[model samples]
Target: MADITTTELRQRLQAGETPHLIDVREPWENEEASIPTAQNIPLGSLPEKLDDLDAWKDEEVIVHCKSGSRSSQAKAYLTQQGFSNVRNLLGGFTEYSAG
Candidate 1:
């Protein structure tokens, strides 16, 4: 899997590139602090949500969590499930928000 830094993501957003973003944090965590455009799909539910993401099979998808741990697992899992363009947001939302 590959990694996407917050700077790169921010630049993309500024450039009007609406890439698919999945927040792999829990509902509570997402509600507390989130990228408004990111879709909420907790890590635990990813297994059952594969079909829901079928449309993004060949699309670029960025996954993030509070930190990077959960999203790393999500990226690995998605790649195994035939997602060719999945990336883990380095340092996740924590670093994204900090900067």
Candidate 2:
């Protein structure tokens, strides 16, 4: 899996680059705030919800969580599940907020 910094990802989104953005954080954390185009899919539920992300299998799926850890795991898992393109949002949402 590739890794993209928050700033780079933000710029891409702002510039009309629409990647398959998935937020692997919990619902409550997401309710607080999230990147505009991000879809919610909590980490714990990802295995069961894999089909929901099937459309993105061939496309690059950007994953994020509160920090970078969970998102990294998510990226790895998704890749192992046959997702060809996965990128971890380095530093995740927390870094996004910091910037």
lDDT of each: 0.94, 0.91
Q: What TM-score, computed on C-alpha atoms, does each candidate reach? A: 0.96, 0.95
Q: Which residue pairs in candidate 2 collide?
A: none
Summed backbone clashes in each candidate are 0, 0
Across residues 1-99, which tens digit of lDDT does each residue of candidate 2 receive?
Answer: 558999899899889998889999999999999988899999999999999888889988999998989988999899999999899999889999999
Alpha carbon lDDT of residue 18, candidate 1?
A: 90
Candidate 1, residues 1-99, lDDT tens digits: the string is: 468999999989989989999999999999999985899999999999999999999999999999999999999999999999999999999999998
RMSD of 2: 0.9
- Overall local distance difference test of candidate 1: 0.94
Model 1 TM-score is 0.96
Lowest lDDT 10-residue stretch of candidate 1: 1-10
**Which parts of model 1 have CA positions greater than 4 angstroms off?**
none
